[model samples]
Target: MKVKIYPIVRTAAVAVLLSGVSACSKMYDVKPQNVVEAKNTYQNIYDADAAVTGVYGKFLGLAGQYEVLNELRADLMDVTPNAGADLQQINTHNVLPGNAYADPTPFYSVILNCNDVMKNLTIMHNTQKLTDADYNQRWSDIGALRCWLYFQLGLQYGNIPYVTESFSDVNTVKDQSKYPRIALADLVKTLIAFMEALPYKDPYPAANSLITTIDTYPSKMFYVNKNCLLGDLYLWNNDYHKAAIAYKNVMETSTPNGPGDSYNYYNTYTLNSGSDNDAVTQSAWLTFFSRSMQDREYQTEWIWSMVFDKAFAPENPFINLFANSGGKYLVKPSQTAIDNWSAQRQTDGTPYDYRGINTTYKMVNGQPVIMKFLYNYVNASTGIPSDPLAKNGRWYIYRTPTLHLRFAEAANRDGQTKIAWALVNAGIKGAYDDTTIPDPTQRRITNLPFPYDFDARKLDAPTIRGKYHRNLGVRARVNVTNLDVSLQQNANFLAMEDNIINEDALELAYEGNRWQDLMRVALRRNDPSFLADKVYNKLLKDGNPAAATVRAKLMDPKNWFLPFN
Candidate 1:
């Protein structure tokens, strides 16, 4: 069940050569033949840069991990009967050690790559080739990526052996006694301390950003930005006050075109125009997962995304699971997910949730197929449909809406219900209408002001011009209906909390993060029944007979964390 650290040297070296993908082809195109060659690889900044890129390449190959670990366990998705035994196990919470998705080796291998970059890059930096700022920035990037690996491990496995240095040989790795598993709480504390010590900024200027060679790198608001991880850790650690502050920094700095910002939210594609068809209604959100916007560097909302170049990196397996034309269509939307959207109706009896409108599955005869991962659309210019085999969608690690929602959760927990309500409102409004609207007076709509700050004041302004933003009949401003009245209003606050949770499910559907959201609320309230009830309800709605068993197990805190092996 534990990752053998010493034997990893051999495995790590093989992985680097096998997966040594880089955005800057000139530097990382060639893989090191041996550990000596790998050590020699970082002779200068170029080599150091290549080493950094290799770490990212290792991280990028985890799109499937996000889908399985983060999403599949949650109620948003149901496993297709023929999806595979492994995927079905994940859906049913009957995962075995042999489950293909249970392999933590890839994540451990990723940590090894980060360790390699940290060691070699430091050696090269000591040579004075990199400026102090450059060295710190690059080192910080490596540290953040390593922290990301540990964070994922902590979530997947309750506790794991914490290792900082690269293993020398198989003998060292074989000695489990040398690397004892550390509690996730302790690991979070360690990461927070390490991250806080580094000279960092939430939204580091895009020009001096890390991973400089890659234009599409999530230099703007990704986990690479320590604040993102800091917020995540703080949230997991239940440090609501600190978590709120961390998330605030992300909102103010990392938001697309926010104060002192430089990178676009997403570059290649624009938001949905709210056209009368699925194509336009889903465009703003769907574009983020489309192949067309994979590497484009323009106006974007992608806080951080895994880069996958069709011509450069290996094929993303997520495409095989999510995409329709070329995918196995293994994962499908659950009945609960369908009901989540169906329950919410606009004034006109239409779905008020645009995301639900676009993300829900449509029935083909008797079979229901999820379309969130299927980005098959007709090319506007080429006049041809997109290829299903195209693995173009970049795996989003963090985005503006999700961050806003996270901040809302933290804020709500900290009793800043207004701020929490505002965060949720912003996510909903901006979800489908992120297109840059002109601010003639340089104010709200035109200036593209940060949505997270909307709760600062109580005012009724003209809503953005979109079908989802207005009342079809009245043609007046859209009323914010979901915001809670006040914290003293217990029922209202609970309703707001529920709204935020649903919003997370709505905004972050198949991209991964559903189960964790449920866990966060459950743990925060110290109410095992809360988590159990929700999961049980979803399972029953889906007609799964294991609902009672899963509910009983979930009532125990130990069962909160999935079994490592």
Candidate 2:
């Protein structure tokens, strides 16, 4: 649980972090370094240039923490015998204050680093060391990261100490009188306000962008997906209309080729004539988590990914947590998760979700292991990774499937249930041609009003085609059977919402999102059982000894979060 700092960090960024990652939450509240060091560090464009990248260095330390906190606590994963007490506590929902994984220190380390960079960047701008364009780009990029980290903190820890200033000393963070803890809702509103007010909402321009040498790993992969983060904030705030607009903006983002580029990934993989026949060849669905971010589809699909290379000194933390060999193998896919994936049929008339059976988790010597992190790392002939010393891969932050799922969630809550249901099982094209809605005009996707607007008016021309006409729904992409919307018999919003949540698990399990997905729905419904029941069921299915106690504790809602101190 004690993840190391990224060894591949920029020199200036490392200098910033030498001070600490324990800062106040507000921007410019305090200078992270003393006046002399601040003057020395923020003197020029080079120092200014390294500031944002430095925060990312600290950010990389959070690789496995996200997966451990998010999935292990949720219903999708279970701890193996090798799992330490910290992981065991997390699994059974009996985490104590001293639990290493429960410590909020690493998270604060990234936040403090963000605050450090933001504070210096502002000073450099005011002093004319950086131009308006340069300052705005760096400032907003770091700000978006801060917003995302804070939102995640709130999601995991609930009412947390929300500090925004740069803390010169680590002990300064304990002074709650100076920087008070706020409710998660308040934090959401604050983040929403902060992000919406930023001048630049898009990816950094060519000159200011964080460019990677490898083409498949796009510049976009290096930074936070600001719009997706905004969409999440709005969704959690229950402003589904605003959330839909935010998500729609991401879906409608133009290609790198000057806004006219045809491919702006909107769940656009085709359902071919041989779609159901994964019986003969490899599945494209599994490529979403491949070793290299090497393909064009990967370019659009990976909204945000934190990559690591052992040769470069940055390494994949999840390899130890999820892998069977050359790993601690502390975690495995839960029986409940396996059962859920097994219940669905792939397009090939197969009995399981292709992403589930062999792709996500596979048996090695008859033991089920999470293969997602180790898939391409392992050799075809042998079951172990090629370079076993230190692993290299990426941790998924947000992706296209998550984008569509979230978009569907927002649309559903905004009273667009049919659209939401379709997004789960079929594409928007299928949503439009819904069997229940007879009229073409009323059901047509092109005519849908603003907030629910996704233009599929022109299917022939690639430029004009819109919102999933080229796309299939989340489940449809994997060729699963259609989700039962119960549109005719019971047309329930919450039920359809439940369907979306269930789809979220089936599509996105072990990607560091399960707990948040389930928790968000449970909170919205004001029903603890919405989350507790599923968690209890997972424990029951796994035959956990503390199932009853865990269920009782989770029913209180307060017990859902970890001990942050």
Candidate 1, TM-score vs. the true structure?
Answer: 0.77
Over 4 Å off, model 2 = 1-36, 214-217, 255-261, 264-282, 347-349, 380-382, 434-444, 457-467, 488-490
Q: Evaluate model 1: give its lDDT.
A: 0.58
In order, what is each prediction's RMSD in angstroms? 7.7, 5.2
Scored by TM-score, the top model is: 2
| lDDT (Cα, tens digit) per residue for candidate 1, span 56-161 | 6656666687678877777788777668889877776777877878777767766766776677667767787677777777788788878878888777777777
What are the runs in model 1 whose C-alpha is more than 4 Å off?
1-39, 168-175, 202-205, 208-223, 254-285, 291-298, 347-349, 360-366, 376-388, 426-492
lDDT, candidate 2, equals 0.72
Query: TM-scores of all models?
Result: 0.77, 0.88
